[model samples]
Target: MKKIYSIPVFLTMMFLVACSEDFLDLKPIAMETEETFYKDFDALDMTATAAYGILCTRDIFDYYIFMGYASAADDVEVGGENTNDWPQFQAVDRLQHSPMLSTIFDSWGYCYKGIRMTNEFLSRVDKIRATDTKVNQALVDQRIAEMKFLRAFYHFYLAVVYGGVPIADKIVDPSMFSTPRNSLKEVYDFMIKDLKEAIPYLKEKSQLAPNYGRVSKGAARALLAKILLYESSYAKNYPGDERFAGMQERWTEALQYAEEVINSGEYQLVGINGERFASWRNPNGGVGGYRWIFTLDGDNSPESIWEIQNVMDGKGWTYTRGSYIVTYFTVRYYYRPSDPTHSDRVVGGWSFNLPTSYMVNAFGNQDSRETGLHSVPVDPKLDPRFATSIGRPGDTILVNDQTEGEKWFPMSFSNLPTQTISRKYECSPQEYWNGRTNDNEGPMNVRWIRYADVVLMAAEAAYMAGDKPKALNYINQIRKRARMSGNTGYPEDLTDISFEDIVHERRL
Candidate 1:
């Protein structure tokens, strides 16, 4: 097994414990230690890539975080064949999550793995000579900026979950193992500092030099805004929390960063009825923009600010390491579709992250959100997004000509209002998943931060900053798109932007 040292133990000792006189007693280095391995830009770049790669792994992105959010949120339920299907998921859904559960530990472990790698890069890269013509000194510095952002990003994740985690900001030494965990306030401050440093060095979208996967200044600023918002509202529950004394200032900062992303005009929503609509594989394809954002082809879509990338190419048991998003969140019993007009595009579900009545009712049978979640079979015309984003009773949900009315409901026996299936992230129509005889893995990208989220953040920040008109405008933009998905125009009557309005929109 890999080392099980707590972050508090490892990171604390990083600076305190020095090599001292032990060098004389130590044996010669055997493996490619930092002294030899971090020799050039190539080495540091590969190391940085590996650091980022950890987040793309199966456990972190698709399975763990996907289920984690669903479980913790009140809008969803952890459903399977039975209540005992997956204990960890059940625990999270029930709000009885344990620290020892692999969900918690695996997340903690991989995040630190990423942190360690980033620290290693930061510690070594600065040591390279500027005259080293083989390495573009400017590029090396930017990568160093990337590593800094990653380190800060990992700490932010840890802080949100296990508050006040140890700060592994540098290379570790033996004495650092005894270091204590820092306060959440300390951690957030560190993260803010790192992101602020990273934003300037990060590339802009028009640079067109880096591939879509790399982090950009927009992402850094967006993440910084996210951090500020979370911190602003975080301490409300804790009375007299000294760490949040500057909460108002932090909130203003949040508004500033959010506005920066908005004014930059580099990223915007992928309107379902706009240019992206024609690119949805087919005009009659059974999916919408929100649904398409998580599909395999949705990578680097304008809506996506940052996402995890993967490709299967039909090589081996690709699902083993590929994102299992479709594998788990898919509609169950896909192998045996009841539709006669089915196509090879659909796959089955595994009964995880089931939507609940609250989730269904959140949309209140409104524009596209209602159609995206449940089938409006009895009245397809009522839902502008019906049939296009989901299945009606007789519509195709399987290959070559399968129809849906054959089954009682979703998941073999799902009844609406009480128990509903997800139209989002359900791997029913992946065009590339047909290679595997048993569709256990899918190739969809995992979108972490997208333009929709940025717009929402801007809306929230605007409302908090007393600019109700701007907040309403931003929120209306999202609603307008939802209406557009149904081929319906968003009415211009949404003028009152209240705190509840912002919250309700976010819930959708």
Candidate 2:
């Protein structure tokens, strides 16, 4: 059993006893308990690594592994083997979810697990100085900062989901579990504090290895800008809220941080004709732009700000090696012929988060994300949003086979199966079935943050701060990247940008 820390002391004790042997013998050869860890910088580094590893678990990052956040939005429906397949997910779609939802407990428990691990590291990181030389102090300090950034991230994750989650900044007394929740403002403030402190200690992406995927200075700052933007949203909808009294100033900070990231020059948007996807999985890997971004080829693309790493092998789903959870939820649940080798595709997804027709129509005038090459035979006129906005009732949707590219077709029973499926992260049939349970679990590295999102965020922050020209500039930057080079889409240059326009841009 996996040990879930960061809950009440009694509960953690009970789990320790139940999950392992005696609590007194917390130091097992199989695992390092708090009593044995943090003795040196290396141990602390390992602990920090473990903290980051938690991001891949089904509890937190594996929303795709189970029912995901998309089902709660209006653009999708919780589809599965049947409407009753996952009532908790269905309840989310119906706005009828309760505390009893397993996802609720899982998400909450896993986030706190991450928090607890980071907190433990922070409390004991200083112990490294006792034995390690002073020359390596700065490196130790950077790791500590990374832990702080991760702690802030997990806290923010809980905040957005639970509104005002308890700020588990430290290993607390058992009594803290029942402690009153902090205000959303308080949570944001705490997260912001942690991030700000972490920023100075982190290195730029260029300093790290190309595929390093570790948290860098840009990641921490970019995330801080996002958090501030979210806080600005609260202020926008409720101006009377005192916590956001200086919302305009906050917006200014958001823009500043965003620009800082852009100026760093360490990362860039994956361009329309970039070599990032030169040969992602095969020779026909020239699907530039949006489709290219989602493939395994773009794992460490310049456009990717931060992402969870995924190796094609796995000791377990929660070990963070690679994930098939996205395929589990996004792919159509049933397989055609129910055979492993007939060449029919898209037969194993759990059919969750099915796109609504409204979503299909929302992608108007562009297909960067929507109906681009990866789309079905839906109408050509659509926004470049929601990658699967195309495909007519009976149109054929292509599936990539691991050995070959886009050769097989989905074996569907319905006349218009593509209408209900999302092709964004679905793996090829061969790759999906390469292992025992890996098909439900696959090797798609889930991208948590990317440059396009940051660009839009900067645009929104500028608009909210009463800078129309700046907002238009930012929006246009994203728009330019969304289309092929030299083909800047409509409103070639927006003389003015409005809040509603920003909203529409975000939707796209």
Candidate 3:
């Protein structure tokens, strides 16, 4: 009996002793840690790829938070059953929001999450470069540059939206969570520096062909120019703000970078009928130029500078890869098959972010026959892009395989007179009926930046630099493309251009 007891006691003592030395210090088993994860080039690439994933998250692009910010503009109305339906957006539209607002918090939190991801990736890659010789050095450099660009991209939004933001240049310890926001100038400077460093390593879009979604040298340049243009414009507006001191002079640098992207010859505006850059992939194809730019088929066109790639996983409410925001813009329960042949007619959505009458009216002279939001452009003197931009009661959309009946305004849903659906970002019937995606996961790539935007930025910068002809020529080019997109002879090239003209073109 004594000997048996002794044996059991001895075994128990051995187990405890074994655990005492390193039980808490054990490497993570359920997930990868820094030491265990960054073991190879593929792992490093994945880590870099994860940083890009945040751009597609609900906090960043998939939800109403960012679009809510746009609602503050006069063109859009936060449409639902009532003003309180989406109070977060309502607050933003009313300019009554605070940091405590959930959308505001989400935007700030997710941006930092993305920033931390990029910072950690950069650190891990740097360590790998220092210790590993077997890895491809060129790929390492490019990945590092890409991470830097991503970090800068995340920081750029924070600076623009919240003014000052904490610069997370590395993976920070939890204890340092209280890090204060840096000054606006400091934040912008960091972003500019990152882009400049990234430019040399990033391949041009031409070299990155067949993989057009990746960041390119032109993307970096365009972003840098945009940041500089923002800074220059802001400084001019509030010259007394010391944070923006000397930024007004940055317009020249902005123009230089903008022109660099333009001269790179890597991007072009998609012509009237998918003529230019025909090789670009569009899964569900269409014909209208400006309209096609927003569809699933327009995924990685030459015009897209930095597009966020989304997929239709059909994993509704399950963290799917699709851009759920499309659901919000779609017409609410607007699906009704008028004919047996039109079984796949237009589907409905949650009915948010409806266009205002003012926006539609801005496109052209409203006909007397048009009544409120039920606008009918009969012999409409509207801009050609207007047909593709705002989907009204009479406008017909692409059903599955054929063009079908006109879409009616959801009068029963809401009574707002000018409440009209935005065709620009809504999901198509094929996207819904394809058995993959639903209202929650529409597969549409958000074109974050485009070559057309770069051209406009160049025009703005040139105008600021006191070169009127250069600015006029740039604006005229955009107008020419607009006409081509619409297949209309109106909206002719301007004889002269002003700062207001550039602004109006941008609004379009």
Candidate with top lDDT is 3
Over 57-117, each residue of candidate 1 has an lDDT whose tens digit, in order, gives 5766667776765678876677665678788888988889889987788778888889988
In the range 121-140, model 2's lDDT, one tens digit per residue, is 88787666776664388887
* Per-model lDDT: 0.66, 0.67, 0.73
Give candidate 1's TM-score.
0.80
User: Which residue pairs of candidate 3 clash?
Assistant: 282-297
- Candidate 2 regions off by >4 Å? 1-37, 64-67, 240-249, 272-276, 279-285, 329-346, 365-406, 410-418, 434-436, 485-495
Q: What's the lDDT for candidate 1?
A: 0.66
Each candidate structure's TM-score, on Cα atoms with residue i matched to residue i, is 0.80, 0.80, 0.84
Task: Name the weakest run of 10 consecutive residues (lDDT summed) in model 1.
Answer: 371-380
lDDT of 3 at 395: 52
Per-residue CA lDDT of model 3 for 399-459, tens digit only, reads: 3433433333222233334557666675545455445434566777777889889999999
